[model samples]
Target chain A: MSDPAGVIAIGWPQLLLATGFMVVTGGITLALQLGVTKALWLGTLRTYLQLLALGLVLGWVFRLRQPLLVLAIIGVMTAVAAQTVVRRAPDAPRGSYVRAWAAMGLPALVITFAVTGLIVRVEPWYLPRYVIPIAGMVIGNSMNGVALALERTFADMDARENEILALTALGASPWEAARESVRTALRAGMIPSINTLSTVGIVFIPGMMAGQVLAGADPLVAAPYQIVVMLMVATADVLGSTLVVLLTFRRRFTPDGVFLEKGWRPHAR
Target chain B: MDVSGPSGSGKTTLLRTLARLMPGATGSLAVDGQRADTLAPQRWRALVALLPQKPAILPGDLRTNLVLPWRLKVERDVAEPGSEALLSALDEVGLGGLPLDRDATRLSVGQQARVALLRVVLTGPRVLLLDEPDAALDPESSSALAQALVRIAATGTAIVRVRHRESDGLAARRLVLTQGGRLTEAGP
Candidate 1:
């Protein structure tokens, strides 16, 4: 059955049919004694439940269409993303949650608004449908970037402690001593986005593009949106990673430019 | 001057502290009557350079390693040595035959130690902190390093050399670190 939007409706039967595919995969895993059988079933269950909950939440937000509610949801999403970043990078020093929040939130919000307001030209600019999805993608990608950067910077600093000390002893400032580590972290953070940009549409169809096509948008129209999504994701990733790295590297040194070895080491507790 | 002590006596820690590379170190330090606290850390480090025991070679050839200090903002106003000056500096350190294009990472431990020393020396520190500069060197290379240190000390730059051996014929005054970390004056 088709809805008024002319998109074919997917009912529980179709969803259950999809679950059958996962069941077949789970069966193979069990047959092979792959340890991931439990993970596969648990992940499949969570995906179904989480997406359904997201659909209900989005429906409620869209119906009310209040800007404040939209913003509150965005705030919650950003906070969760920030916490996820810190959690993923367990080696990051203490008090990184606030820094991660700022790093991920600021650029992601700015870019989301810029895209929705300027590029998509969504009316009222706070339309839940446009802002939430766009902000979700931006914050999600930015979170990944920030997490990778924090992890890489801490690991690199620990590994190259001697090199950093050598630099400082040569009259290099703290920034100068940590420069190589920062560069490596930024590269690590941005490389996935760079690869996505280069290989988009050829290696695989991105999720947003696939969704838009499945909803019956013109391929040409959907292509530009996907392009915008890819570009914005790349921009947000680089900016977030840069901010996190800059914020965190200084913590590796004292104000006097001495490399504090204990500062970057993962705490025993 | 030479700083000597048995192993585990905090000799390396002393040199690191003097160069202001130790964060836990506390006490007043002065250079040429100027207090260390009054100086920017970069400036303080430029005045007092430390050569760590392990040689750290940057990812480049010999020329890049030698010229690294000059590239730092703290050394911006200082003149970078020319190829001739760098060549001669290598010569002075008994690495006369090493090529400027030679990859620094490929150098022997002893050779890299000398290059590490040369890297710090090029910064023209007023106080040089060497942590066992001769630890990896052969007798011939060690002697060359001693001569170089003597010449550098003659230029009025206070040199602090940490040595495991009793004699290098370079120190006019010596200090010894006891097991308890007390420093005592010893006759040269």
Candidate 2:
């Protein structure tokens, strides 16, 4: 049982390839969004430096083998990222978006460690690779889902504030006034993942299954894991999005259900 | 009912409070015999849309803005109003046959207000709370705005004017924001 993974050889090549992929992804996103070459270079490089620093920190921590520590790191990352993204959305209330992210991230992380731990106990409960990746997969998707959910819900409230007023006119309570936007926003947030499910293994080869196969695992062995991973991601995203929308709806509006423009930012799309 | 009084009487605050932004507000003012403080104001607003001091226009066509409220789940029956309807509403408000696809913000102040007022008409808010409206208008534009308010009021939508200056030509009940941050009724 010889391991090809070596501090002994082939180090810079792997590192270079990973760096290349990272640059390409960030470059494409920035180019499409902002369309400035210098901006893309600087933005992507910033992202590269940030991820590298984080990876260096996580690498040492993971080697320490405390599952609880791994869970905490992921939890904090999700919470902070969620706060950052939602806080920047246009028209968001001052502190509500950041608070909502923490609220969503806390529950999602608890579920991450608890439910993932319960299911992952196939004799050795602390498979760092699986636990970490699966947690990342679930929580990362949840982070995006929550962000979109908050952004859209707030936007919907702003754009359709009259309907909210109408609902209020029809004797709907403040919570009831936001019901439509919340539903539409939640549904909107789930669409990408739902579409991904429909196109799974067909439109593209998913990375998880491909990675397992490359590591010499059977396709059958990888298939169930991939399927479970996809499902969990969808579940976590939906749960996190739904909770964020609901709690956020309560905090986002005036008691009369007027959309508080200060609570969340706007999505350009 | 015409109310004309001094400046800084907090007329805007009255509208905002009426909208339920002050959930923990302990004081009370009744609107048509119901406590405005406790009544669910969103519902109140559907029947009555307040045109804020400066209702911002998003970067979109006039038709889109007019009909946006109808698409909300709460407004299942009100279809997105067509461009012709929006244009017609605008026309009724003295902005005859303006471009519906024009960028709203790029419109002149008077033009934008007409479009917004048309939006209220098409969207069907029964009460119009206008804040310092027509401050930027030329005399002709202000006169037209005055006429539009009269016509809208005739349709039974109560119009409340919070004005900083008199003779914007709105012949309606006016609430003056006093220097002491209170509303005292006055007549022209």
Candidate 3:
């Protein structure tokens, strides 16, 4: 299915229906003197451009199911996801973007391979239909997890500086001193996934399952795929956040367990 | 030895530097003639402990907080004291018969201070660095704390304490920190 019939293609008329709502919202904001009209219009334009570019790229990439091409696509997505995480989490330590990249990229790659190769068992093991969507879900969730973990861990360390230093002063190693903060960060990072697990079926159909159903796939099949996606996403998120926090906490302290006093940064404060 | 100075005199900074808690501090500190920086932090801390003005108590029972540091991987190689030893240390700090399961965080500041003091004493460090050890204590508690320090000192644990009050340093060799971080012996 080189050209799988496009999924519920929305023509310009249908898009105009959505655009009309945004325009009305912007108009109301302007009339009320809220001054958000510019933001509304700009956001709409940016979203439209980004999604259009993504659709075009995906269309080209999906036609060629070559392993190298598939890997390259996933790599680019992971890089963008990592950069997004670093940008969103501005309070993280300096030079944390590289660590963020590894944290999100490694876990996403591993989870994508396990799902695509072991469970889903795609014929080429790099099917754009399966691998691309799964990679997007896993990497996207992992990036969010990494960002949350970094932000929370840094804040926790700052708030609990006394506790950390107390432990260190009593012979705790750097890792030992940061054990509590790491635990807190991991819990904070993973809560979204845990909440999703409980709310997946009853609350609302998730995006992947909804898209599959809209594309004319069987609900039963889409439901199972959704379950698989959820598990992979949670695993990637947990692993990514865990690694990022564990790696980053060490940088906050000296080898001798003394916390390196972080100078005041505008966002870090 | 006692360190006395006005506010912002760096007395607390000196104590922390000697304890190796402040990485930015530059100077050579020694314990038993051994260079402090040469020793591993775990080893150095085991030998020289600092009791900060406000001791941070973990979220656990008194017993757990007392033994928490020893439970770390770095301290795993050292032999931990038995419950009896811990109780003895508690008794030495006027906390005899205090329930082992009592929450450390819930203790009064005075009681928590003693517990923090007892925690370091239990480690049997060769030197104790104290920052206003009785700053929060009442008269009775302060006297008790003094006796505890005397007993620990009698055991050959050298103590260097920072004190804001003149009366607090009467028994020790007092060094006043002047305006420019200069150390001078207190006048008689």
**Model number with the top DockQ:** 1
Give the candidate number with the greatest TM-score.
Answer: 1
Per-residue alpha-carbon lDDT of model 1 for A1-269, expressed as tens digits? 98766689889899899999998999999999989999999999999899999999999999899999988888889899888888888777777888888888889889999999999999988999999999999998767777999899988988888888888889888898889988999999999899989999999999998998889888898999999999999999999999988887787677687877864444752
TM-score of every prediction relative to native: 0.94, 0.59, 0.93
Interface Cα RMSD, each model: 1.5, 6.2, 1.8
Tell me which of candidates 2 and 3 scores higher on lDDT. Answer: 3
For model 3, what is the error of residue B6's alpha carbon versus the real structure, in angstroms, after optimal superposition? 1.6
**Which runs in model 3 stand beyond 4 Å of their true positions?**
A1-7, A262-269, B75-79, B186-188
**Cα lDDT of all candidates, in order?**
0.88, 0.65, 0.82
In candidate 2, stretches whose alpha carbon ends up further than 4 angstroms from where it belongs are A1-10, A13-59, A122-127, A255-258, A261-269, B2-27, B30-188
Indicate the DockQ of the complex predicted as candidate 3.
Answer: 0.69
Q: lDDT for model 2, please.
A: 0.65
What TM-score quantifies how close candidate 1 is to the native fold? 0.94
Deviation in angstroms for A254 in model 1?
0.9
Worst 10 residues of 3 chain A by lDDT: A260-269
Candidate 3 TM-score over all chains jointly: 0.93
lDDT of 1 by residue, B70-131 (tens): 87889443579999999999999899988899999999989999999999887788999998
